[model samples]
Target: MSQPSDKALVPFVSVDHMMRLVHRTGLEEVLRGLADYIEADFRRWELFDKTPRVASHSAEGVIELMPTSDGEVYGFKYVNGHPKNMKEGLQTVTAFGLLADVGNGYPVLLSEMTLLTAMRTAATSAMVAKYLAPKGATTMAMIGNGAQSEFQSLAMKAICGIDTVRLWDIDPAATAKCAANLAGQGLRVVPCASAEQAIEGAQILTTCTADKQCATILSDNMVGPGVHINAIGGDCPGKTELAPGILTRAGVFVEYPPQSRIEGEIQQMPQDFPVTEIWEVIAGRKAGRVKPDQITLFDSVGFAIEDFSALRYVRDRIAGTDLFHPLDLLADPDDPRDLFGMVQRAAPER
Candidate 1:
């Protein structure tokens, strides 16, 4: 076998390469870039083919495939959420994604989405907060200090001008880990004793706990008026984080109602419970925060379109750089009709 042509190889961003790329480009810069891409796609949301993620549930966890296409490119992510994994010294969520040319159906880029998902999730939160968060909001209450805590804090800082993050978790060690990681990241990190304490004096309240149950991370009385709630943890059918009273009081916003109604905080509400799509708010077709006293809730259930945007951003940003390796993932024969001949010709190398 000679050398494989470039068309047969897809660019693969490994975990190491992704870390180097984030370091080289600056982490906050990448977060802001992802936010921009997500926002841009949201502005043209009607152009994409959207659907709820396909999920397979088990006793331990759930695996999902999120897919979307915007006429030119198609993207999908394979992700798993296992809250029990944390206690087993493993990641609660891990993912990988691919982007392909819609016309030719050949993958153009493949990358680890474990880091990318964390970044994009935070970016999506902050971007929505930009439109719905109280004006001039600078402080955010980070209620969950898990793997996503640092990314969410920095994204808010970089994208929404938030300079202070008050961190809290049921586990003090988790809060300590989050605070220590964010110590020198240009934000004022305060360790709070409880979730209520974390939200004190904060304009934006972010909840990201991982219990895999309908536990109330934020109670009704704990949440006051005029704060924006970025609820991102409840991503499965039986998982939730907020009180029903909070949802009834807040003006709820969602990415896609079909998915959010099944997997978000709004899952606690009735089937006909009113909710506004965040894309409409982003496109200026609906209201965001009309009054300071009105509570704004973004019941975020991770959507496929956001992953498509993040994948698109990674593909464009990694070009002309040695941040990814070429993966011989596809078999490209000289003649499209003779796949057997191409395979037989390569058998001698084995």
Candidate 2:
């Protein structure tokens, strides 16, 4: 037997390895770095291949493939969302991803995306808030204290200078857990009794509840002027966090309109509803929060380009480091046309 060639080996980041990498680089640093990558990609949003995530929905959940490319490299994530999974002691969302060279379509990296997705989602939120949130904002109300709650809080603290996070959830235990996890993390973690209390005095309101129905976490009157809403949990069809009146009044920003129209908070709006892509705002083609009194809403649906940027960031950071293991994920032959010969030569005593 021969060792696999470098070309045949792909860098793999397991859950353990990904955690180690996060700790080694510092979670705050990783979040900021991922924001840098995401911002860069969003600045040049026209180059990448963009499409809505292909989703297969069932009574219980949805499985989706989010794929995008930037000419040189391509990336995609396989993710599933099963809100009921928590009842069975499983994560509501789990994911893995791959990156490949577009030239030959050979995989360059294979990694766990569950953690990466959390980090990227937080980073993307903070990034959008950086652009849309009121200047000098220090408090964020995080509704739905699930797996994403802590990450979102920390990212806001790290990237957007948010010093306080007010948390609430349908399950008080979840809020307790999130508050406990965020203790001594350089931010004030406040567990509120109701959604209105959570948003009180919060300049940024982030709703990331794990529900599959058209539930309104924030009503129109609940949202006052001069607030930025980062609505993330309502990411698929039939799920929404904000009320229609909120959408009617706030200046809405989205990742991609086609997908957001079907999957984000805008799903509750009209098909011809006007919205601005965040990329356009980042590129200065559109306005962000023009005035402090204007309410801004970012209808984030977790675009493929964000996953692509996260994968690229991970691939670049893991270079010359022991954060990843090599896996023989590709079949490579000395002679490209003699793949059969290469395989037959390896068979013994047949």
Candidate 3:
């Protein structure tokens, strides 16, 4: 019998390997490269398959499947969100993803997307801020200080040149951990006492709390003009971070309207609420920030296309590198038509 061809083996990136890859390639470079890929995809947004993620909601959490394709390559991510998981010492979110060739329907790469999602989410936030945040912006207020806080700050530094990040969370220990993690990252990290203090003097206010309720992480009064709001925590149907008044006052931009309207911050508004898709802004079909004083909101809900772009970027970077291992995921018989013979031969050898 002949050995399985390369096509039968899928490249797998484990968690340890992913961390090594990040360290080997540099975190900032990876963030910037992911942003580049996401921006490129957004510019050609009309060419890909788009749909709201299929979700199964429960009292404790929700599981989701986010899928997208560009007609040449196909990608999808399986992710879950459970706020109570932290109490169990488990992650609030976890994910894995794959990329496949559209021509032959064969998977090319499989990766641990938990860390990659953190990077991609931050990259998406920073990329949106580059287009919508005030010109010459240098400070950001990060409202949540969990696993995502450091990534968001670093991505902003890499993409938008943000020099200072003010951190605040309900738990001081979380804030401390985030600050400690970002000590030598070349950015000024200020751990604030309250949400109001965190937003002070910040041009980009990012809310990423993990409460699965209509929780107000930021009040309307706390929000001021000329600030770009990256609201990522309001991802599920009932989960939100910003006050309804904030949505009413800001010019909201979203990834996909169909999904954003159902799962983003705009879910608080009327069904006919006016909002612009971010892809149009990247494509130059619509303006991002016309005036510096107009409040802008990016109600991010973690779209499939962003994951697709991240997978594409990782697949490219791991090429010819020791960052991935080959997995014998598919069965390739010596004769394509002789499936029973192959099974019988393996059974006898066993």
Candidate 4:
């Protein structure tokens, strides 16, 4: 009979361990690497197994699960969005994710995804902007100042070369917190009184408010020609940000059409409404920002492929590092037909 060996077992990663990984890898490098993964996934869009996200909505908040596979590897994330959580000294969102091997259906790694979601979301925005944003988008206006503000701001500055940030939120304290967190980040941070004031004369405009309903944060008059709007929030069925009129006037871009049609700002429009998927641009099959005077909008509802790309990124970047925990999601039986024997052996020894 074979006995268990003395070899070290799999290591588990905690939230603090992940933070250390981020600090060691550096945010800019991670963003750049994640962007490359996202771009590659988008380029081979047909190979991926895609689906609309599954959601569970409640009066207080909503929880969601996103899963995708690239034929070889599979990954999913368990995430919740509770806008009122801040009242209880918790983040509005909490998440964790898993990556598995499709051939064997065994979980290879598990890690906290709340902070990683922020990183991936910001990386995705900057990635889309790399293709859709104007050649030199310097000044960006951030309409929502919350937990995601600092991450988004840093992503733009590092990836898109944004030199100035204009911030505005309904709550002054939220804006103050955002400004304070980003103190001395090389970019000039400006706090504005209203959304209109914040977006005035900016090259790039990002709206990431956490409101659960259809909120018209950007109106037709507020949006100027030649502006790139990165819509980060409003990812669910009833959630929307741009006024219907604004969508009609601008060239709207999306990550995946099948899912975005149901979750993106395009949800407010008819099925026949014209919009371009960013993958086509990345693959050189379509054009992005053809002219400087053309208004462009990326209705980002977030996607599973981005998470898949993120898992791939973290795995490759932290290969030897301890940022991942080996999860025993699958039961391994020494003998295929002796599962009950293993269970009996594991029961309290008498």
Please report, as a residue range, the 10-residue window in candidate 4 with the lowest summed lDDT: 1-10
Off by over 4 Å in 2: none
Taking all chains together, the TM-score of candidate 3 against the true structure is 0.98
Q: Note the residue pairs that clash in candidate 4.
A: none
- Across 223-259, the per-residue lDDT of candidate 2 in tens digits comes to 9999999999889999988899999999999999999
As a TM-score, model 1 comes out at 0.99
lDDT of each: 0.95, 0.94, 0.94, 0.85
Question: Candidate 3 at residue 26, lDDT?
Answer: 95
RMSD (Cα, Å) of model 1: 1.0
Task: Find the 10 residues in a row with the least total lDDT in model 3.
Answer: 341-350
Cα lDDT tens digits, model 1, 71-167, are 9999999999999998899999999999999999999999999999999999999999999999999899999999999999999999999999999
- Kindly report which residue pairs in candidate 1 clash with one another: none
Model 1 spans > 4 angstroms off: none
What's the C-alpha lDDT at position 111 in model 1?
A: 98
State residue 57's C-alpha deviation in candidate 4, in Å: 2.6
Candidate 2 or 4, higher TM-score? 2
TM-score against truth, every candidate? 0.99, 0.99, 0.98, 0.94
RMSD of 4: 2.3
Better of 3 and 4 by lDDT: 3
